[model samples]
Target: MSPSGKPPRAVDIVRRGLLTRPWRSAVEAVRPPWSPQESQFTQACTRCGRCVEACPGGILQRGDGGYPAADFRHGGCTFCYACAGACPEGLFLPRDGRAWDIVATVTAGCLALQAVECRRCQESCADGAIIFRPVAGGLWQPQLNRSACSGCGGCVAGCPVSAIKMEHSHGRSLAGM
Candidate 1:
């Protein structure tokens, strides 16, 4: 509702500062394995850097606000639970629960989508989450099986074009290309 007594439209929400802007400057950071929801994690975490030092894969780093986040540029998560064990606070869930709801997403920049043959992403995916399907007149297209993806980020750093990204699985759809 507005002071003018007119019903608010979707655009009004954005224009009137009731909703956040849609654009993002960077992708959301991935937290360490077994981390609680972002707000809870931030509230509970002490930025002690124990989880980052304990990471055998060396993927954990001090991200924004000095909180630890996963940087999959070097390797994928092994789900070793070392980060969870090293946390001095209750910022993480039990290791028996799923780590997080993240999954790998392939963007339009994939080589195969441009008709250039490439299978690096598929090869790097140990969980066999990435598959290639043949087209009548085009090269095989990469298809991500969201259910099979372990969200390890194995394919992210290995991609030649940097097309892969980790996205929350809530409303994300499987690869259509």
Candidate 2:
């Protein structure tokens, strides 16, 4: 009912419906680049979709609780800072700071590690972080150059065996994949 104590119109009903859409509890999701710590980000963000919509790489998506999340299945980040510019809440940190400690790691499931000739991940990487090094067994093993890795996740989806994963560099897992 309105303040006038009369019936609401159709537009009012639709607006209420949209505002009342079911909201899920926050979870461990991959946040966009230059985002603050998860705890701080959730607290500071206002659930506006501007950051996700401003991403030129198309890697950002509307995630849990209508928050912005990074999805790298399609492409790598160009580090264009469009998301940060679009944010009205100023939740993201400065671009000069490190974009988290995340980095790409090649798991044992990699086809190249199994004595199979595969280089899809290497081909997809724009940073040249994945290096094929010769091992004692005369097999070319894919070695990760942590310093060179940008953690853009470009190689993850291109791996034929799904062997690539992004994780914190200090052995702590990122919780949600």
Q: Estimated TM-score per prediction?
A: 0.81, 0.78
For model 1, the local distance difference test gives: 0.82
lDDT of 1 by residue, 43-78 (tens): 888999999999999889898788888887877899
Please list the residue runs of candidate 2 whose C-alpha ends up more than 4 Å from where it truly belongs after superposition.
1-27, 175-177
Error of 1 at 148 (Å): 0.5
Position 125, candidate 1: lDDT:
97
Worst lDDT 10-window in candidate 1 = 18-27
**Could you tally the backbone clashes for each prediction?**
0, 0
Candidate 2 Cα lDDT to native: 0.80
For 1-177, candidate 2 gives per-residue lDDT tens digits of 989999876668766767655431222467888998889999999988898889887888887678888776656777889999999998889999777678888888989989999988889889999889898888888988999999888887688777887777776544223
Could you tell me the C-alpha RMSD of candidate 2 in Å?
11.8
Quote the lDDT for 83 in model 1.
90
Q: Report lDDT per candidate.
A: 0.82, 0.80
Kindly provide the TM-score of model 1 when superposed on the true structure, using C-alpha atoms. 0.81
